[model samples]
Target: MMSISSRFAVGIHILSLIEFNKDGISSSEYLAESVNTNPALIRKIIGMLKKAGLVEVHPGIAGTKLARQLSDITLLDVYKAVNVVQKHELFSVHENSNIKCVVGRNIQDTIIPILSTAQSALEKVLENVTIEDIVKDITEKENLDKRHS
Candidate 1:
């Protein structure tokens, strides 16, 4: 099964770090450290987020920040920011299916609709989850764990 690209998660991690450290400018190096990745990869993800209007990078300061309020940024928005999959389609159908095989001949017709529906379902879930929701959940879980400890 095709998986959602890691770029999406990295983009979210970058945004979360920026949100958590709103007082400080987020440089590519800083983001890379937080993500345990190289600066180039972080910058690439930052470029995608910038293009999606989810992040803003300052040339003079050489730093980045979230462009909008956390509550306004949905997971779907982040998903689109870094995901290159066509139309946010999660599944890649096997190409070069044998025409002579009945299953192969009808697979596209039979599977495309199901895949589309699955994608829609995922989109719906993502649409409901904003960055604020994620941050709050993380904070709450951490607090709960702290109390337990």
Candidate 2:
């Protein structure tokens, strides 16, 4: 089964960290450390987020922050920002299907609609969830864990 790209998760993680530290600057190096990845990767994702109007970068300080309120940004927004895969095309159909075979010839046409429908369903769920929602959940869970400990 095809899984959502890691860029989607990374974008969300970057945004979450920015939201959590709105008062402070979030440099690519800082974000990279938090994500345990290369700073270049964080910068690339930041560029995408900036293009999508989800984030703004400060060149002088080499840092970034959300362009809008956390409540206004959805997972779908982040998903689109850094995702290299074609939009709404989560499933890739085999291109080498033989035209002579009945199933092979019709496979692309037959499966595309189903995959499109599934992608749409997933997008709808993502649209309902905002960055604020994620941050709130994370904060609650951390607090609960602390209380237990």
Candidate 3:
């Protein structure tokens, strides 16, 4: 089975870091350190987020910022911004099945609705969850960890 791209998680990480360090720089290099990846990859994902209007990137500047408030940005927004799925499809049906076989001919038709319904359900959950929600969860978890420490 195919899995979602890592870009989606990295995109969220970038936004969360921007919010956490609002007063400081959020350059690709800084984000790369946190993500444990290369600056070029971070920049590529940031460019996608900027094009989606989720972030504002200033040329020759040392940092980037959120284009909208955290409450207004949802997981779905970041998912689309980073092109996590091609053509918004979470599942891909196998092609070139032999039409001579009954199962091959009917399989695509039989599973399309199920896949569509599943995708819709997943998207609904994503839509309801905003970046603010994630940040709050992170803050709570961090506080809990500190208490334990």
Candidate 4:
């Protein structure tokens, strides 16, 4: 049932953790603990992030760090890195129900425009959100909650 793979949530987890620490060097093992997943899985996720130019991993001695300013990074940027977008539409409905039914014969044609418009609107909404905005929101909430407690 799941079409798109949402690794953005995971990427955000890694990025948000990085944002919290100014200069704390983190290894894949540390990230693995935070994510409660295998080190190899975390390493793979980190590799993706690196490939997307979101983070820098130092070999030999130093650890991984954010490559770009968090504010400069968009949610879309991170999402695109990990998301496996469905090449085709979510639902098929390709098979013609019955030509004699009249309604069935024309349903696909009738729904195409509606479906296209809906898809465009959805994309526009997604474009409106950025990772910087999300992290800022997270900061505000954490600050507020901490003050209360």
Sort the candidates on TM-score, descending order. Answer: 3, 2, 1, 4
lDDT of every model, 2 decimals: 0.87, 0.89, 0.93, 0.75
Q: lDDT tens digits, residues 73-125, model 1?
A: 99999988886566835677897899899998899989989999998997889
By the lDDT metric, which is better: model 1 or model 4?
A: 1
Off by over 4 Å in 4: 59-62, 87-117
TM-score of 2: 0.86
Give the Cα error of residue 107 in candidate 2, in Å.
3.8
Candidate 1: lDDT of 39? 93
Residue lDDT tens for model 3, 31-142: 9999999999999999999999999998999899999999999999998899988653678889889999999989999998899888988888999999999999999999
Per-residue lDDT of 1-149 in model 2, one digit per residue for the tens?
A: 66667998999999999988878879999899999999999999898999999998867776797899999999989888886557756777779899999998999988899999998998899999999999999999999999999
Residue 147, model 4: lDDT of: 100
lDDT of 4 by residue, 44-71 (tens): 8778889999999865655578899877
**Global Cα RMSD, each model:** 2.3, 2.1, 1.7, 3.3
TM-score of each: 0.85, 0.86, 0.90, 0.73
What range of 10 consecutive residues in model 3 has the weakest lDDT sum?
A: 84-93
Count of residue pairs whose backbone atoms collide, per candidate: 0, 0, 0, 1
Query: In model 2, which runs have C-alpha deviations exceeding 4 angstroms?
Result: 96-105
